[model samples]
Target: MNNETTNSFIVQIEQKQLLLTALWPMRFEQVQQCKSWFAQSAVKAGTLAYGADRVELGLSFANESFTFCYEDYSESFWVTADSAGGAMLLSELAKEFSSLEIR
Candidate 1:
């Protein structure tokens, strides 16, 4: 059972109190290619969140809320939601793949 997270992004818009994220193994190049598609998906999903190359999700009554961004150097993607408080909802939004932890 491999349980390591990849493909993550942090969607943050604190100025609006809306936070969202994703935890999937989406490569930086991949994200770069599908920026428009991701943005449109959020809109279609009714999140209405936007960014230059990322997607932001608004806080929803269902308890999932987040805003995301990318860090190219570390190849790190993050999702920030209060988890125990349904923040994981944001985490769930990610389309990810699983891999064994390399230690």
Candidate 2:
């Protein structure tokens, strides 16, 4: 990506504090899959919300907004903003969940 696009994307990302391609929610059932994936890592996820039919994952990592959160109520996975170094960390995490099905 060019500097302009990258900078612009970064601006947009900061504005929203997330990296959502299209704002579509995931299926609630995917929580099971997400749980399994998260379990493999030692990182602890913060609970944003939860109920009989809803749950939300929120966590701040390394004193940054770098988090991989999923909301059962909204059924959406939200990627928090990350620095260049954080991106590298996320890249490694990505290798484990290679088959992320976005809905």
Candidate 3:
């Protein structure tokens, strides 16, 4: 990771906020997974939308113009942009999606 390409981001959902950090080596892959997660999770959380594949993820919340997609070759599960809100929504839906449990 180099100083120029590394980036940090913050996502706010309602009153909660989350911080995310990424670097060049995995930025593209991370962005893709984040978008995919946002699309699927958002839909599941009742934030229904027509296009999941077209959703975009960003490394910075300041600018919102980056396009993202899933990269099957990635090795991690990362979320981005609206993830804070998406996480809260998903957390609320988890109770309804309860098919299994752990102790």
Candidate 4:
């Protein structure tokens, strides 16, 4: 995990007082790809929140929020959210990339 990028994302979430309700582990490349898909798919449904580094990305949909960050110990990226809808949307997006393991 890149401390600078991770901390930036954490600060944003804290400032928003968002609750993390779900987390999905994925590779760095996978996370990037997911970010692109999200930016395209949610363009009509929500707003995109992109940080300085490509790894720090998020989406706001309705009342839910989805964020991409790194899991330090796992040395991998994770997609976190504040609601089940976020998880559902991620699942739907992952369907387009069979290699992505949502669990």
Candidate 5:
């Protein structure tokens, strides 16, 4: 990761809107896999909506929460984390997927 990407991850203490990408565009199956990962993480109040070109995911964990929109065309994930815990959760997510880029 570049300095900008690394710094952004550290500088954003509270709410952050991040664009997550991989080497290739993500498919619907990949999105489903992500959802399953969240479920395994014990997220609360989770919801998932699938569309032809996108998938939306919302999850809450105690005081931390995040929402994600995966765009198939761009193979990117738009993520918003609203709290410190949420930010930490996002960090954990990035660790889980080594190919994920936080930008």
Candidate 6:
């Protein structure tokens, strides 16, 4: 396998952190596809937590040109990224992806 480090994006909603890192076979078009997938996905509330009022939410974004994943939650259903700390982390990764040259 290639040892090169591919670019990846991370998501954090509240205290939960989700990572989305790019994989091998770098290609600008492929990266763009991933970016588009992220934009198209709808962030829905996850499941109920143990003893909190917070609701977990699922973040579905592109892992590659043809892959995706549904993040897990511990104690919530819906997460707010507009005014959450994790938004910044996600933004940073997006910015990094934007700067990267696909291949």
The TM-scores of all predictions, comma-separated, are 0.34, 0.38, 0.21, 0.34, 0.56, 0.22
Please give the TM-score that candidate 1 achieves against the real structure: 0.34
Per-residue lDDT for 1-103 in model 5, tens only? Answer: 2112331132122236556544444557767656665433445537788888888887675557778677877766666786766776765544433433322
Worst 10 residues of 3 by lDDT: 1-10
Return the lDDT, model 6, position 87. 46
List candidate 3 stretches off by more than 4 Å.
Answer: 1-16, 21-25, 43-103
Q: What value does the lDDT take at residue 20 in candidate 3?
A: 24
Cα lDDT computed for each candidate against the true fold: 0.38, 0.43, 0.29, 0.41, 0.57, 0.32
Query: Among these predicted structures, which one has the highest TM-score?
Result: 5
**Candidate 6 lDDT over residue span 45-87, tens digit each:** 2322222222222333222111123222222112233324444
In candidate 4, the residue pairs with backbone N, CA or C atoms under 3 Å apart (3 or more residues apart, or in different chains) clash, namely none
What is candidate 2's lDDT per residue for 1-103, written digit by digit as tens?
A: 2111121122123332443332344466655444444444444455544556655565444454455555555544445545665554553333333333332
Q: What is the lDDT ranking, best to worst?
A: 5, 2, 4, 1, 6, 3
For model 6, where is the 10-residue window of minimal lDDT? Answer: 61-70
lDDT of 4: 0.41
Report how far off residue 87 is in candidate 1 (Å).
Answer: 2.1
For candidate 4, what's the RMSD? 10.7
Error of 3 at 8 (Å): 16
- Write out the backbone clash pairs for model 3: none
Off by over 4 Å in 6: 1-19, 35-81, 85-103
TM-score of 5: 0.56
Better of 2 and 5 by TM-score: 5
Model 2's lDDT to the true fold? Answer: 0.43
Clash number for each model: 19, 2, 0, 0, 0, 15
Evaluated at residue 25, the lDDT of candidate 6 is 37
